[model samples]
Target: MDKNEFLTVDEIIELTGFKKQSCQCEALTANGFSYAKDAEGRPKLTWTHVNAVLNGQINVVAYENERPNFGAI
Candidate 1:
């Protein structure tokens, strides 16, 4: 997979409109994005998740425990 597959810290900052990492993570979490944190504690969001959310392939709140359909992409 490409390294650019994940949203960078700057992109996450811009997306959530938050300068603080904690706040950004919280905002993403509130929006139902399942993310992992890097060694520096920065949130890591995959393009797949973003695409799934944007394409309405899955419900943010309801699909918390469900795996997104990777084949659809």
Candidate 2:
């Protein structure tokens, strides 16, 4: 990834299909996600963080129906 490319809280929300309270913002609050400040001191997340959450490393699945769509793997 390029240094200019980074994920925002909103983008991570869309990619992970998680509610703001349950994802990035919460991660930031709980210190579960990786992030840094922008020039304005706003939080910034990375694709790596999104992927980790999506892959269940952080175990954010709140509902059984929302578990990963894994097939026969």
Candidate 3:
């Protein structure tokens, strides 16, 4: 897999073993992988994110972005 390339739909299907987009998305989400739908509604994920999730490392920026900061409290 190229560093700059997003995982192709075939790759996603091979990984998740689902031919349907919805199932693929759910599988990816359930596994803590972050992805966006392409113009064709296929899940698109980066190799970096996949490796991070597989290696037990969360994407820090994404994790931080999902929480509310209460610094002023």
Candidate 4:
């Protein structure tokens, strides 16, 4: 969790299998994701934050899937 290492949006998308969207950004932020604007003003997430989310230390509701209802057999 080096503060110097930062992941780009594309990396996050690839790692999390999430489609690029504003909603995803919002979800990440809500889930304890720490981001800072790069020189281009693009949001850059710290590896610490990414790992936190991946390790379940940070929970994102939007990324959670609802349990399937199978009805009665």
Compared with the true structure, all predictions reach lDDT values of 0.84, 0.60, 0.83, 0.64
Sort order, TM-score high to low: 1, 3, 4, 2
Stretches > 4 Å off in candidate 4: 1-4, 15-24, 58-73
What digit string (tens of lDDT, one per residue) describes model 2 on residues 1-73? 7765787556756644565444545556454455676675556777777577667776643533465668947
Residue by residue across 1-73, what tens digits does model 3's lDDT show?
A: 7756788778999988899999999988777777989899999998888888888788655775786668857
TM-score of 4: 0.44
Candidate 1, run of 10 with poorest lDDT: 60-69
In model 3, pairs of residues that clash are: none
Candidate No. with top lDDT: 1
Give the better candidate number (3 or 4) by lDDT. Answer: 3
What is candidate 1's lDDT per residue for 1-73, written digit by digit as tens? 8999999878888888998999998998777777899999999989998888778886875776576778899
Best by TM-score: 1
User: What does candidate 4 score in Cα RMSD to the true structure?
Assistant: 9.4
Per-residue lDDT, model 3, residue 30, is 72
Cα TM-score per model:
0.78, 0.43, 0.72, 0.44
For model 1, what is the error of residue 22's alpha carbon versus the real structure, in angstroms, after optimal superposition? 0.4
